[model samples]
Target: MARKLNDIKSDVDEKRFLFHQFFYKNIDADIEIFISHLEKLTKVFIFSGIIRDFFVFKNQKPFRDIDLIIEEDLVLEEIFPALDFKKNSFGGYKIKFKTVDIDLWVIKKTWALNQGQLKFKFDYLNALPKTTFFNFSSILFSLETKEFITGKDFLRFLRDKKIELVLKENPYPELCIVNSFYYSDKLQLDMGDKLKSYLKSNYTSKMNVESIQLKHFGKILYSDEYIRNKIEEMFTN
Candidate 1:
């Protein structure tokens, strides 16, 4: 049986052990293969949604993809020579191993930081939390040292089941708005004050629903009228 995140103590070592166990059990790839390749890098971290989902839903939810951040610049071919990898739309490498799909990129090339949507500070890992659109996606787990790095509100918001916006100025404001609705509906989370305000302010004539659907979901998951109604209900209620 998979260990529950709540059962583990707050100690870093204990959390690390639990994270390792979670990784091994949930991921279909060979653990040793990833660990060995990851160890070769200067600094690598498994960040964002996967870590958050582990804490929130445990192993009950299927992970969409594993997001990895590598601090150093290196060719994907050189690092994981054994595995087949390809470039994703967001300038990251995508690898499909068994039932899992991994998306990895150099830390410097992060979409928000690279595109100047967010500034990159001296500490990349510390600055990472600010790049995400939501607090739940702000957590980072170091693959090398096995330590978690997160924004102050990350755990709190998760525990409270609240959706808070971490960064207001994102490249995809429309997508962020869509995601806020999607996550709130999927996770049964309440919108934080900031998120509520953001939704109210941004859900105006500027938002292109069709563009958001194509860019984010790749297909029409929510009808145009349904999306408008949902956004209307979010702010009005």
Candidate 2:
């Protein structure tokens, strides 16, 4: 049986629009209480790909999930029940909170022998900017819960400052580290040094250099060589 193309398009469109409504308009008690609870935590950051959704895309829509960071080891099971969420030890929480799905991860920092300084890594997801779902109010609650929205907000905030580069570029050093990870072998002589240098200046520590070198290295390291080659090929084309 042949399916109508318009039907598929309609389905996708409906989902997108419905998702938008869930974010901008929907507010519920479960979400509200969740936010209120998060407000009390200290040393937490609300980040992950969800933050990317806010920073990179249009429409300040409510995300389908959230990625929260808690520096101290509190039991997710103990804390998240008020919101109809459950805890699991892959180092995260799973919640059937409301209309949306919520996957919450706990953050624990560890020591790294490779570097003298503590390598602030995600013990939960081994990734940053984790994704989970919440209502608009829940997201607002999470933001207030951690008081670390400043890092995520910085992305949008920087655009207003006329910084001319991505603002999230500052706190998210992993985007840069991935490059060093892949390129380390190829440029073994310089890779380690460069990785350390990039991490220290960009990720581990902080710096402000009004040039695109760090980003360039990141692209060169992590992005596909074919893409790089294709862009170079464009000039000849």
The backbone clash count of each candidate, in order, is 0, 12
**Model 2 residue 99 lDDT?**
61
What is the total number of backbone clashes in candidate 2?
12
Reference-based lDDT, residue 105, model 1: 83
lDDT of 1 by residue, 2-99 (tens): 33334332533356768867776776546447856676766888887777777777655466878888888777787678886888666688887776
Off by over 4 Å in 2: 1-27, 41-44, 80-83, 109-237
Index of the highest-TM-score prediction:
1
State the displacement of the C-alpha of residue 111, model 2, in Å, after optimal TM-score superposition. Answer: 12
Estimated TM-score for each candidate: 0.82, 0.38
What lDDT does model 2 reach? Answer: 0.39
Off by over 4 Å in 1: 1-14, 30-32, 78-84, 88-90, 117-120
- Write down the TM-score for model 2: 0.38
